[model samples]
Target: MKKFWLSLLSIIIPASAVTFEDNDTVVLLGNTVIERAQKYGYLETAINLSARKKKLKFRNLGWSGDTVFGHARSYFGPPKEGFDRLKSDLTELKPNVVIVCYGAVAAYDGQKGLTEFLAGYETLLSMIQSSASPREIVIVSPPPAESLGAPMPDMREHNKRLALYSKAVGKLAQKHKLQFADFFTTLGESKGLTDNGLHFTPEGYQTAAPKLVEALGLSVATGNQLQSEHARKLREATVAKNKLFFFRWRPANETYLRLFRKHEQGNNLKELPMFDPLIADAEKQIEALKKTTLSLK
Candidate 1:
């Protein structure tokens, strides 16, 4: 029976048929899972290596503890402001692909949150379509939370709740004809994969990176290649670029610069655009490092 259902899903989901084009800008949007990825660069590094032949640009727009409602992104403003920021960022990036990783935060609300979660996710997709007109959108399910035992709470029941949300996400993807990556099932609960039964450790991100690429129906790099010195350099450059882009969009003191207190230091807002050239330079380094890695491979 399990095998039968799995086969049925393969037919319904089309999980391994999507591809990326040259020069495509891919944006990662979600909560902590996506946000912390930028720090390790494993996810970005894996995708870059997988699509080494293509000149892909990546932007990590993940905000810690964010939701479909853009709650974490709102800062001092109302939740609507956060939603607006998401739209603005997407419009500005003009991404060719947007990979959304949500549900972990929403699943905390359990059954009651499912309906609202699905609704918000649908609205977010609509917003992405209208704002960026992306060539493709991929929705990813949050991986199962781990259970470290002892003082840490066992998340076995929580994993069940996450499974419900993950399945709903897959259905939503089918309805929209968007790509779906079910990490919840593919990367099931594992010991030492996370620090707090939620966020991943450095090694955790590295280990899960390739699984993410595989879920996207893309090629995967060998273990040694991904850990090579050249690959590490590429990841470092990628992280630097993401940091610059982060500051570019979510500048410090946003309240004083562009929000309610802009009257005091709004003129400094002009400095924000200066990060573009720096970001571009970082991209060049990343591109160069990628070529070097490929040459060796």
Candidate 2:
């Protein structure tokens, strides 16, 4: 429970100088924080809002309680098997920009696993760079846990350890000359934001999203704030579109998709393909909407 709470607090959504290009397929990979990002659509909306081009694609592939070595995806096997799954997905996505977030769970080991953690991180980075041949790679540092004078368990200690891990991430980014964003250094005064000291409240994600946009490229446009009805609808559409994509990426009742359970419900696999068209429709809507929003600004 301690590790889980502390891990949740270690968010790594980042801002960078590398803005999205027209042809870029931006892929976000990480843990629960990344999964939760899709619900509010703040981060994706901000990235799209800051884009200087049209037809950019965004894919979020974050799973809860994942580790640097793909532990969460292990699925009752060794972590290397999960890493292979990650490799396969990235290869298929062929993303141009891959933004990675990890280090919270690794921090749970404290100083003991820091070295191994970094090594796995480097390995993961190298594997993706080699396989995906991505034009841009960005590493994000996890956000620190905040204590608002509450009787929290060893949060101070957890944060202190996470700080060291974040530093290691920055140093690795520098070595590779990749873009880096340190949410640990950013996200000031997180008290009363994240309930349970880890996961993001919708408001918490809303607060962090623009900062993430700023870290990725240009500052978020004032129009992106939804101060106007058009902006509000556009933003709302973006969220709705993201929700559809989520189903496409992570469908429910996955026990039928593959493995032994397919014998009973394999026929449903054909139904899963239907989501592709829905996802495409949402993407098209976003492209059309982005034009109106851009013109309005």
Best by lDDT: 1
- Per-residue alpha-carbon lDDT of model 1 for 43-158, expressed as tens digits? 99999889967889999999999999897888787879889989999999999999999999999999998999899998999999999999999999998898888899988778
Angstrom error of the Cα, residue 237, model 2: value is 2.7
Clashing pairs in 2: 11-142, 11-143, 15-215, 15-216, 16-215, 16-216
- Give candidate 2 regions above 4 Å deviation: 1-16, 223-226
TM-score of each: 0.94, 0.87
Q: What CA root-mean-square deviation does each model show from the true structure?
A: 2.5, 4.9
What is candidate 2's local distance difference test score? 0.76
Residue 188: error of model 2 in Å? 2.9
